[model samples]
Target chain A: MSTPVTSNPAQEESTVDHSKIKVSPEEMEAYDQSGRKPVLLGFFIAVVWLLIGTVLGDLSSFKFDRPDLLTEQAYLTFGRIRPAHLNVMVYGWASTAMFSVSLWLMPRLCRTPLRWGNLAVIGILVWTVGLGVGIALLLAGHGDGLEWLELDRQWADPLLVIGAAMVGASVWKTLAARNVHHLYVSIWYVAASYPWFLIIFLAGNMPFYKGVESAAVNWFYAHNALGLWLTTINLGLIYYLLPKIIGRPIYSYWLSLVGFWGLALFYALNGMHHLIGGPLPSWMIATSITASIMMIVPVVAVGINQHMTVVGRFGAMRYSPALTLAVIAAMSYTAVSLQGILTALVSVNRITHFTHWTIAHSHLGLYMFVTLSLFGGMYYILPRVLKKEWPSRRLVRAHILLVGGGMVLYIVALGIGGVLQGLSLLAPGEGFEASVSSAKPWLLLRSVSAVIISAGHLVFAYHAYLLAFTSRNSLTRHPPFYELKPVLVKKRVP
Target chain B: MTRILVLIMGAMATVIFALVILVILPNSMLSDLKAPPQLKQPGQQELLGRQLYISNGCIYCHTQQVRDPVFTTDIHKGLGNRPSVPADYVYDAPHLLGTMRTGPDLFNVGTRLPDRNWHLLHLYQPRALVPWSIMPGFPFLFEHKPTAEAGDKVLDIPKPYAPSEGVVIISKEAEALVAYLISLQHNYPAPDSDALEEVQP
Candidate 1:
């Protein structure tokens, strides 16, 4: 390992001081050039999708309070818009953002400039086109009716699969040509996610399954899309960022090993827990519940590893927006994973299964955990690649507070309302309409929260646009400005 | 662990194991499932209605699966006579076993309210039937005629929901949708092997 370790605090500090280590300017420049085009393209596309998806999500949430608001057009109806919003956010925004992060991180970790950069660029463009066309088809009333698989199987899905493959090829090729002897933990996660995603995506979209089997496959794909794909990449990013920003090695390398494998083995079975109390076999649900509970092993391992690493270095977040977002995202991962385990239990699933509570839980995972991590990744990568600091610190602070505060309100409102709605549904005396009435106020609050989140996205989009396009440079370069001037290096060749 | 190939193989093996156990095994075990005698294949119009249901994304709000009566209140709520079974959905291609219940379970909605007129009116304007309903009215599925023609199925929309200048007539799409909704009955007794046993308290 290149980094030194010691038990003595003073000696350790001196040994691990970042400035003492030499880095070749040419190598760093090569890494930046290799990733600049694909990463920037992916980020730009992701921001646009984020804006569009947020609007669609806001409109869908509002429909709960006023169903007649946009009923004039079939395309504008709640059903179409809701799925459109979900797809746009998941595929267009989150996946693209993640791809960009992976593209940037892989080269840096491998100690090699990225290979096939042009192919990665092509992949991003193709994925963007596929998503755009798929959403249009969905709005035009040609959806596949499966939740996450709403994109047309023949027309849109093929392009996505091919596009993702192109990007994956680039990532793998970069990994194969690594200069480093020991692969980082992040490499395992980011690399494994591509194949895992491909397997589940193909398996879920298969047309053969019928009846309860289809539901089984649907959720297996959907939940894994979160666990193996989204969860894996974000966790990998956090593992890298948390330690890097704090200028320390991870707390325990063994804990990371347990966490990574445990996630892969157990998360796939957790999907069946979503169908608890439904028509599926009891044994299937039982296995899933067992697996869901078993997720605690990985969740806690990851939790402790990240927490201990940053315990004394909490002040580092003040200097780095990326660290701030990563810390929060790591916390959300623990919270959402624990909540998921509880919800998987039969008793809890009985209440939250079909209610808005599930929606709240999903947002906590997707928005709080995954999206925030992506934002942090972007904040860190954008400055380095663009050779500029964020245009305005005020905009960064505003983006954080708005999104963070909005999500807290969103989860709380819908969480309580969903529980009450579940109770009402279970009460023999209460009519079904009572359940709807009970959730109405919370649904309205959810709409308000959506608007807040949309505002945050708008702010983030404008800031990103300025950082990428405009030449405005901030006088005060952020800390870790060591990259801009490599004068501290005592010239060393690898 | 440092080798890329080892990492890839290990990851792939774990997911394949999951796929086998969760998907392949369950599918093989349920492969012998036979549709109950009463669960007939949907006719031409009902199939058309099913298409309409899928296209309009009705499955987003409405679930087709009815939960266990003993564990939940699905039976007491009149969603189904018994818990739905694997055999109950043999005809479903991409199963409409929805996740959310923003509206209500529609697995046995056909058996609950079989009245064709009520369904037509409900589709044209949900508030006409249930004042507190948040379901969007499918006005595009109905026509606004100045006067009802002979043999036309006119929706009995109440005031405030009905158009001020014209009569509301159910179009073929609405009729097909209603037909599909009304055909959701699965009250047939599931085979003992496939049936979900209620847990005695």
Candidate 2:
């Protein structure tokens, strides 16, 4: 390796020339290969948790329509199952997948080998144990009973914090020792997310905030966990993967800055939409509504940047699984955010506040936007880290179609059903029970869609298993479309 | 950007935003809040029932707070008599102001449906009573007795939902849950809330 360039500390400026970083292709490739074991371990764990989460999510949804199906088993009761499903999905699947991507991305971005790969493995193990304990207690009837904060913080939370801290510290250390002078926008997102996670996780689980204040803090924690923790990292992954896959810089660097800062400024206040008609002060709700609407700024900024960059690269999406998923995720991010702003408006909130529309909206953000983007990141990262071709092109195609189909069915059924249920609730003569009954068909359909999605998850898990373990000699293509280049060209809007 | 700028932005958004909006502002505004005359601390039975309610994630389906009619239709729908204020929830230690109304608002469920027997039977098998309630039955909170004991109160569950060979007696947990459900009355108006209502057009 070239002698380690130790420049004077005072020469470091806010903007460093990207060309001066001097990270040779070999160095970059070495960094990518270094994270192989830990990242794959994370993916394996995440897929397994996703399968479990899908089953539980389906069982929980089914109970809403058919309450008598598993009444005998307390563990399978809808109440326990619902929270368990949420925890598993959010903490187990989504978070684990995010960690895997972050670990791989940090090393590449920093132009350094991951400093503590073994620590991340240990952290993942600890987190799995914490999740297991939390889920078991929830099923055994011992949860703390706050939305998103259901896991008993006293016992289970510290383990999570410790696990997260171990992983987070490793990233920080890698960043600190970086030979690169300038940090990318993606680095800004990844670096900022860890602190936000730690702060919110601690504050949300604390016993100090009580009663009405607790409700406020609860939303603060819940919404920010999605926004700051999940949204931040996934957006970072999108920013990284899109440019790398398409072999081009983002359309507008300044717009990316606006998008990142806008998200950092606005997302904390948006959680109060969950409390529009709540017992809090009206001004608080209005402020939150205003912030929620302001989210369009960042959403549009990111949308323009990503879309403009991919303007002429539509054909590249066919070969790159990562680009295809990222494009879908970027589009969903825009759609879901605009939808969020509309739902937060007083007129719409009056009709849809308590209905299934909120559920549909959340899934649009979580499943379509966050989870799908992570899937794309996984597709890109796995082959690079493993140094082998993906075993089956058909499996990846099948996984995408399955998830896309299931998600559409799930969101459409719930969206239409939520509107019908809301209007029925608003209509004076219709009894409340009638609204519940009217929603049964839609809820049943949601359960069916969940099964379809679960099938996609199994296929993904099986494919990942094959890619991780199968020998290199058995693969058809050596590098799996490594010579791919930009195939889409931008056209003038006029 | 400098590392300090990153730190500042994250802090301003996550910590400072929550401090100003969620904690400082709301707490300062509602500092004068006191429970209305009718609202009281939950009794021991009601507390146990509330625990059961929480443990079972009842808050996921049922919301407790009703909104202002000027903004929404909660009043006209008879979900609550007036807009709930912070004072309405002062006695509550852990406020259950749920987000979803998959079931109707339970702020004044006690006043709307107060019959004790109705609650017990309804909890045992919601479909048997309402014929279309999506709520899960709390059979785990009740027990099946071969015959009614000397002091046992047999639930009048409908023919289909009734245990095939035994009398369904309300267990202690069900009794506590019903007691908690019955104690959810918020019909009486607080002075501050009524004044706000009078000011509205």
Candidate 3:
């Protein structure tokens, strides 16, 4: 395992297979240097927001069990803090983390140094300030009524829209100046996310759309923000990291085409499923449900392709932090997508809609799938950019266990509590208070789970701090292939 | 060039399509929608209450729309007298048809539960009425004075939730919010609400 792999410059012509197997040292160094500053800044800011969101989430959950806990103060009330928690997690943590990875990956995949690097850094600064201001306003009781778009549009939207555009423009410039001929699948995914994000952010925050229609637009933007922006970028990162780590190409290149196109076509229509049994026309909901069911094609295609790539190399997960989180995230991708499909069905939607069951489903998608995937990608990317190694493998393992275990406890309790609540609401003679009472035990459990999740965030934030600022010489220079079998496996050809 | 086009266009079209279905088409279809027969514009107090509701993020927990009985028993649960319709919300700007039903639907809450005192008490301390409610009491919206003044309306809060040494008085904001809640009554017949067919004998 201590044996160093050699890179012979002339081997690009001497061996056809070897050319594809290794990236040139010069290219690797160039890719590593590109977007280094913005990525680090993003990572730092994302960790800070993550910790804040976790604390807010814990306090909100605690308030559910004991309403009087913070009733003395208006700003700390559950109504304000709950939305504040969501905004912090979604916009502050998820968006910034995705942006950081996308900034690095886009330039690398294009074989070009990031253009307008200064603009990207400034954009991040603006965005971070805007998000903080928006959150503060929300806490101070200036929030809009929309679920995900709670920040006041007049005050907050311009900063976010402009800041995101500046950051995204740099990535597009990098894409336009690509040194490579063939576009990788990951490049396609990353290229698409920035534009999609801008369009939706503007459309959702527009002042004209109102009444019942506003609700429709709200879900349209909210769901697509998750689908096109967060989910797409994470998928792109996985596509890049999985093969890059496991020393192979994607299992089926053709299958990726099917998955990408399927998602692009179907995911938008599926947003209306959130409005099932709503005041909208029946045809609208029916169309959304159909689109939702069609999501299975993409989900299955992507799932099969990703799983088959790592079929025999499950051992790689033991060694690679990136691979471990990516695999768990990949599994969760399938689970959440299928779960979403079922939940969109009319019968299931009847029972689950407006219940905590949907909350569990969303956490499955957001926490389990998107956040875990980003964690994996960051692990792989941060070391390369910083020219250092992780300070502790124990911290990485601890993060995985804590986050994974907390989500399981959280989702399960919410799922059962939601079902019971839904049933109690539906029963002819059951009182509303009875349903409320039944969810208390689960709500208390959720608070405990939040504490566990917060611990995981602290561990990750500290680990990142160590990797970024501590002595570069103190950490290992080589990749920590802790569980690989020293050398490449011999192919057993018949 | 082709690759860039496909990538950009592929992403762009998703939002465009969503806008068509969710925004444009729905707006065009319901563009002529007016207030239902029994609908009236919210008065100054009710509008203030609506703003307070939005500011407080009540929409996070209490949805304002009740689904058809086929999909939910919200009507049977006494959340509303009938299914809510788009026209029922024509006068609303930034409609608050919330997603989660953590508490009961409040579309017809004002009609079904008419006691202003009950709402005031419930808002001040939810557990005073329902022992197991997880809803946080809005203590900030009420003041606990040593005694009620001439014009101050005293609350009849039950024991334990009430303060030991003071009378609970509802603030003006609480009063406006209650006025808005009562104004939410759409129990009147509407073309889309199925109000005529579903009338209780």
For model 3, residues A266-286, the per-residue Cα lDDT tens digits are 887788898888777777778
Q: What is the lDDT for A244 in model 1?
A: 82
**Candidate 2 vs 3: which has more lDDT:** 3
* Candidate 3, residue A204: lDDT: 86
TM-score for each of the candidates: 0.94, 0.93, 0.93
Q: Which interface RMSD does candidate 2 score? A: 2.7
Ranking by lDDT: 1, 3, 2
| lDDT of residue A305 for candidate 2 | 89
Q: Per-residue lDDT of B63-109 in model 1, one digit per residue for the tens?
A: 99888877789888888888887778889988899988889999999
* Per-candidate DockQ vs. reference: 0.58, 0.54, 0.52
Superposed by TM-score, candidate 1 places the C-alpha of residue B16 at a distance from the truth, in angstroms, of 0.3
Give me candidate 3's TM-score against the actual structure.
Answer: 0.93
Across A182-257, the per-residue lDDT of candidate 2 in tens digits comes to 5777788887888888888887888766567778888888998998898889999998888778777777767887
Best candidate according to DockQ: 1
Give residue B43's error in model 1 in angstroms.
0.9
Runs of candidate 2 exceeding 4 Å displacement:
A1-23, A472-474, A478-494, B2-14, B28-32, B147-151, B193-201
lDDT of 3 by residue, B1-201 (tens): 226877787677766877787678877776677677788899999999998898888987898988878868887888777788777888788889988888888998888888888888888988888777778889888888999999998888777778989898889999999999988898887565443223211
**Model 1 misplaced stretches (Cα beyond 4 Å):** A1-22, A474-476, A479-494, B145-152, B193-201
